[model samples]
Target chain A: MPHDHHDHDHPAHSPPQPDDKVHSYYQILGVALKELLIEKGIVTADEVRSAIEKRDQITPAHGAAVVARAWSDAGFRTRLLTDANAAVAELGYPMTTTRLVAVENTADVHNVVVCTLCSCYPRELLGLPPAWYKSRAYRARIVHEPRAVLAEFGTQLLEETEVRVHDSTADMRFLVVPRRPAGTESLDEAALAELVSRDSMIGVAVVRQP
Target chain B: MRGPHDVGGLDDGPIDPAPHELGFWEKQIDGLRGVIGAKVIVTTHENRRYVESLGDDAYETLTYYERWTAALSRQMVDKGLLTQAEIDARVRVVRERLAASGELAPGAEDVKP
Candidate 1:
């Protein structure tokens, strides 16, 4: 007889408790599975830890700093607009094979990025993704109704401002270099970086004068 | 199959301005994912493919790290790096220990891996 013991009458596990605080079955499973992988020597705990540390190194501030420099130095902005990967590397931000694309927002144009396939962002530069970026609602709606979504984010574009939404469907990740607000001609690069919020880099909002 | 994860241009709701605090296990899973990919065991494409094959409900309901780990387990088993029996044993032990300690619901003791 063929060894069919694999399907032995093991009972089903009930779904997670409705206690609301209980970890989901999948979450618990993840913990156990990760342990097994580590035990088997397929990967080291230090490797995973280093990967996490690398992610923690980047923040919205890194992306903001780049945007700030672009604001103060037209040359950098032009280079960023032309070759974002090189421009970001010039700033000593970690570089990988994934291409970085910086889209500039001008008076007549507003750009927003949404990945329809997955929640891919400029992770190497902006660190981890936000909850909303991974939410089904945001992913499904942003591509079609970017204007409405931006409004929800409290970003209202001028009627004349063209809403250009970029669907990051390829290997390229996008960073929106929002237009500098007026009355900020005196602000230096460091001060300008402080004004660049995470959402602004994501293109859901614009950089405003403090 | 057109997975729910491919949702784009579909209407939803407002973004919660609140920040998300990653749970302990989430951090581990995400890091493990990076290490796994760095090892070239599974590419992002393969991971996405596994995620999409998890059926629409699991894909939609599972948290980001949950899906990543699930797909990872799937790939590890597929690649012969680990066995389902070993994984099931560990999962069962974890559930029992937690359930016994009241960390998990008491009824979870009867759960089959």
Candidate 2:
């Protein structure tokens, strides 16, 4: 493996040791770039700090809110299916660059998403993708063997249901609007949103009553 | 002609759902990229293309943010925003300062790839 070359200097079969002191080449390069950019008057340090905070502010809960509203409001569901970008904008989380496509799950159709080419996730709505979502295994198998992959996530589907996997791109992203679980009519939007997990929005698992 | 990054639908290992906590340096790189991207210094498309073109050795060997930082540095040089020499000098200064402050481990520079 190409990565093996990085371990050549170490004694063979030695356990990996975590070093907190030395900065790697890429880490140094990243800091240098940031400092150079700030010195060049291209961007301020405050801008970078604020940008990180903004990204951290977005999480799976935001997507859950959208899904909860869709479950309770038929009009919102129609709008979400028709124009996801506009629908999300109504929730004050507008996508500035890419278009969002919310794929709906039904009795006979199950929807899932993957970026075959790269990790093109809806970060604004769901925060950064989980580590598994970007793993080579998930990226390689999700598109072709979705049933097996979903099964690994503890999501079992019936033989009659058709599984659909949507491949995301740089300009287009996907969000799985999972079906609301049964017997949740008494729950309000906030409570319903609480049941929605990050994996469920990625279509690996289904939302369940807790 | 599949890029090294285009690993979809081929035989691979089982999915490891273990989550990794983002370190301080990783978050800073992400923040820098976000700020530069928002300022139109580099588009996400360009970032992806650069990352894809990093060759198989780097694409496979480096972590996600490592690739991003490498690509971002290359993009900065290509765009004439910063020169290679300038970046190298800055790196040296950072290393020296850290070492003088006893933050860098001994023989760390020798072990660098």
Candidate 3:
């Protein structure tokens, strides 16, 4: 008699085991120091470690630089529009390993990003993705129906604002460079960077004048 | 050759008695090939019956698999084994197959390769 015994035998191959390591919530960002330690003897380990350290040190400064450039230089903004990665690199904050796509939120189009898979993020450029960003609720809901998800995050866009939801699949990731808010025209670049929370980059929160 | 139960701690984290976590029996069934593939399909299905059978937790887990499959499909497309159109077609086909089989529940459709 022909039976599905081959299928039956499959599950019997291995038994369930318990996961003892309670992963640190922060480790999900892949910025944890231990990853560097594990790669100590490897060729690129030193560079990776240095890159992570540099990323942590310069995230705020990078934000400031972008804001400053936008405020002062029209050409820089155009360059940012054309190739954000290169523009950021020219400013001395090159994204490491992670490919970055800067989604520009304008009067017509609003952009939101989510890593529906294992969190592929632009840690070098945007720092860590917030805890909510990595949550199962956000991961499952965002890509399917983004407007509803953004509403949950307290960002309500006008009907005229086209919502572009960019799904961060495997290799590439994204960050939202929101349009400069109206009231913030008076504030300097440093002040503007302070208002740019990680959530703003993820497109959950808009940068507001402080 | 890897059993679904074996993957528990490796990927699923610590076990709990809650119905949300896959139990021993559930893991056994999930280790079967058809169940994994069908669960992947159920996530993409819009049909109410297929959606309801997946339950909330299973649907969430399946989302991870869907991402995995999407990445794999993209890679396959890039490598020329399939095209983007073909991958989209496969996703539609898989969804239809799962919906018709009435095995949208976790581990309900375990088939041998």
Candidate 4:
């Protein structure tokens, strides 16, 4: 492997040791660029801080809200699948200009997302992707071996089921709306939304009954 | 511009199923770039192209946000916000301050191929 998945011998995600002053070029570059931009009056520090916080606040729950609503309301589902940008906006998510495509995972078919080029995700809807979602392993393998990768994520499909991989790009993002699990008819919209996990929405796993 | 970063459908290593929580510095980089990108000074397309042009080694060594930060720096410099010399000087200063403050990360200067 040309790349070391482990970062700088820090035991898998250990807290930054106190002497962590040695900065990578990116960190230095980030600080430098931020400083210059601020000095140039191009952007304010508070502006950047708030933007990050907003973006960081997005989670699968946002997507789950949409999905759970869709499950209860067929009209909303049609709107989401037909025009994701407008539908998501109705719920207050301002997405990129790139269109969002909602792929339905039915009994015979499944769906997943990846940006084979460089991790182009729907940040407005799903927040930032996981590290593995952007890994060389996933970008390379998921499209070709969707079943195998899905297995790794604990998603086992029936022999008759079909797996579909959505290749995200700069112009489009794919969101998987997994099938509504069984035995939850009595559950309310909020409760149903709680059953939807990020992994399930990513098409790597199924929403489980609770 | 086409290289290893475009790894869709290629065989590679195992997926780390860990939850990738962003740290403060990572959030700062994202925040900074997000603010800059919003100004229309540098489009997301241009920034992504810059990141892809970083070659396989740096792309592999750096984390996702690190690449974003590096590419943001390059684009900012290219966009006339900073000269290469100016940013270089700033990097040096950051290093000194960090070292003096006992936050000096060891071997951070080494960029291995």
Docking class of 2: medium
Model 4 interface Cα RMSD in Å: 4.6
CA deviation > 4 Å runs, candidate 1: A1-22, B100-102, B105-113
- Candidate 2, clashing residue pairs? none
Among these predictions, the greatest lDDT belongs to: 2
Native contacts kept (model 1): 0.56
Listed in order, the DockQ scores are 0.44, 0.56, 0.03, 0.56
Estimate candidate 1's alpha-carbon lDDT, on a 0 to 1 scale.
Answer: 0.77
- lDDT tens digits by residue: candidate 2, B2-112: 999898888776788777667777789889988888888899899999989998877776778878888998999999999999998998887777778886666555333
Per-model lDDT: 0.77, 0.84, 0.48, 0.79
DockQ class, candidate 3: incorrect
TM-score of chain B of 4: 0.87
lDDT of 3 by residue, B1-113 (tens): 53221111122221121212322222222222122233333222222224233333333333322223323333334446445564444434443454476423333233211
Clash pairs for candidate 4: A21-B103, A21-B104, A21-B105, A22-B104, A22-B105, A139-B8, A140-B9, A140-B10
Score candidate 4 by lDDT. Answer: 0.79
Error of 4 at B94 (Å): 1.4
> What local lDDT does model 1 show for residue A30?
79
Q: A142-203 in candidate 4: lDDT tens per residue? A: 99989888888887899899888889878888889989989999998999999999878788
**Residue A4 shift from truth in candidate 1, angstroms:** 29
Off by over 4 Å in 4: A1-22, B106-113
lDDT of 3 by residue, A172-209 (tens): 67867777777877777677777776667778777776
Inter-residue clash pairs, candidate 1: A140-B7, A140-B8, A140-B9, A140-B10
List model 1 lDDT by residue over A16-45, tens digit each.
234533355556677677788889898887
* Residue B74 displacement in candidate 3 (angstroms): 24
